[model samples]
Target: MSVENKKLPQSYYVPAQSPWPIVGAIALFFIAVGSGLTIMQLNNSNVSGVFLLVIGLAILFVMLFSWFKDVITESNNGLYSTQMDVSFKQAMLWFIFSEVMFFLVFFGALFYTRNLSVPWLGGASNNVMTQQILWPDFQSFWPLLKTPAGDTTQAMGWQGLPLINTLILITSSVTLHIAENAMKVNNRRKLQTFIGLTVVLGGCFLTLQVQEYIHAYTELGLTLQSGVYGNTFYLLTGFHGLHVTLGLILLVIVYARILRGHFNDQQHFALQAGSWYWHFVDVVWLCLFFLVYVF
Candidate 1:
């Protein structure tokens, strides 16, 4: 074969060892410890736990900023190849799968508590003697607003703010899809407009969620201390809210990249990943609405 006709072996780019992973791990450790302490100190009027939490979050944010900056620079420099793109896509898929399992555990807990545990406690399946001895007045209901311990809380209904938030999320997902379509057609104006709308919708959803929480705590007498119902409600919805916040951050980053002429129709894995995550968040909210609010 002629020298000019010889095929060159493809080279894979390997990034140098970096400190960001360790820094991120340390930040997570601080966040976990700080959050635990904060929860423990809820009634003690201690501010140290809050201080730690803030520090941890600040460090985390810095780590993310630096990490993403490095990634963007590398991409802009044409460092990534087709293999790297495939690797990123696979990583994002696995990440989303892990998130699905993470939520499945909580949903499983909700199901078990509702279908089996509560029923057993209420004298189902020949446990009459058990119920009689344990608590004769305890009732087995779906919401279980009135706990066996005599703590009562109103259940959050699906008619008002939650419904509105659900619609907003669904609409945001649609808007993001439209943005993706616009990206495919190389219509920067349409892409930016749709994504901007999606971001606004996300912000509105979060605002309404905060208002809903305020209503629950102040007006509805619902709180973490209310009982198992309250515990499940807050944990599920609160975690979902955190996911929504993360999705919003990702969308904002994608929007900034779009403004900077970062992505093209054929190579926009970051935008695709962000869209997948946003869709996942929307689906989770739908489940939460049906399970927690409606039935």
Candidate 2:
């Protein structure tokens, strides 16, 4: 936008043309292509997907940094009025709402399969004829490990890594809150320490999640192709993990800004935004722990 001071505005702030939007769009394209290729790599030994995925992620990281830097620069330049703050907050809320809807679709699928489809296939209600004509020996059970073609795979247990990761996420949420409070009080040392702790906890959660995936594939016979159960489980947990990764990056950048004294207690919207996102991630994980894992 205009490189002017944050002065009184007679109207709402209208930003000047920015290339960041196009740059972000390009990053998203690379990510989509890379993700499709990586999924294809499960069957074929194509390493190009991994290469593309890394490049896409790198570009995405840079794009986010540059875009945020521009906005923060504008804010510091006093170009943002109260109206701009409200707009920022409204946009963030809408973005989070969109994320909620995205996950709701997946969760709805899980509910449909577990509560309806499985039983229908097992001869529940009017599906008696379906069972007899399909597989008379079919048993309706959670996980549905045995495919119709007789491919047998084991179900993942909720007891080990899943439980540990849940606890880690909850703890990280607490630490983030503490850091937020510390920032509000201008306790830089406390804020930095707790933020560091939260980031470490996030890293640990990701590492353990990777280990869990490895265990699932190596020992539990679980994979994306396992069945409906596997599909829901991986899709839910995998997307949540990706969100956590993004939040971790957000916190890292916020930490850097904090160290540079870019925010005061009264005007730390960036920190607030990051904290809001991380808390949302934590809540999503709690849902997954119960609905996707334990339940």
Candidate number with greatest TM-score:
1
RMSD of 2: 4.1
* Model 1, span 3-62: residue lDDT tens: 999987665779999889999998888888898888778789998888888888889989
Q: Model 1: residues >4 Å from true position, as ranges?
A: 1-9
Any idea how many clashes model 1 has? 0
lDDT of 2 by residue, 1-295 (tens): 5658666555666778988888888888888898888877888888888888888888888889888888888888888777777888899889899999998898899999999989999999799999999889899999789877778898788899999999999999999999999989989899989999999999999999999999999998888878787878889999999999999999998988888878888888888899999999999999989998887
Clashes of 2: 2
The lDDT for every candidate, in the order shown, is 0.92, 0.89
Candidate 1, run of 10 with poorest lDDT: 7-16
Which stretches of candidate 2 lie above 4 Å from their native place?
Answer: 1-12
Model 2 lDDT vs. the true structure? 0.89
